[model samples]
Target: MSGEDFEDALKYTLQRKGWKLSTTKKTGDFGADLIGHDPKGRKVVIQAKRWNSKVGVDGVNQVIAAKAYYRADHAMLVTNQYLTNAAFELAKRTGVEVWSRKRLNAEIEANIPSKSNK
Candidate 1:
């Protein structure tokens, strides 16, 4: 998926999971694609990356900066691909959640609405 498409998909997914979501401006986003409050009202800042290659530390740094800038309680970096080792290390140190394809899929599966509920 393209970057824009990934952003949209993430927005929809978060909304389905009961987040009040909003997208940042395209030109001057400063690394944040989506910002919102989760179901329990914790603030969240997210950076969405859809790339063929592994993501780098730069993206992790951006999300960390954005979390501070937005005064969010949680920060997440969601990517269609996996992160580089450097990025993973940085995220671990910074308490930023990194959601690669596997994690994302697991989250979706866990949160899927039951047939009876739907």
Candidate 2:
């Protein structure tokens, strides 16, 4: 999927998980792709990356700045591909939730209604 598509998918998944989402403008977003409140009402800022190769620390850095810019309580980086070691380390140290493909798929799967239930 493209970057915007990835962001939309994540927004839908989060909405299903009870987040109130607000997508940023296509340009000059100040590094935020999605901004919203979590289930418990804490403000959250998210940066979504769709890349062919491993995602780097730039995504983490952007989300961190986005969090500060938005004054959000939480910051997260979601990527379709895996994160680099440096990205992971930085995210861990900065309390930025990094949702790589595995976790992203889990969240998607968790929210998808089973066919049997449909």
The best candidate in terms of TM-score: 2
Candidate 2 lDDT by residue in tens digits, 1-118: 7789999999999999899998999999988999999999999999999899998888889999999999999999998899999999999999999899999999999999899998
lDDT of all predictions, in order shown?
Answer: 0.91, 0.93
- Name every residue pair that clashes in candidate 2: none
Model 2, C-alpha of 82: deviation from truth (Å): 1.2
Q: Model 2 reaches what TM-score against the true structure?
A: 0.95
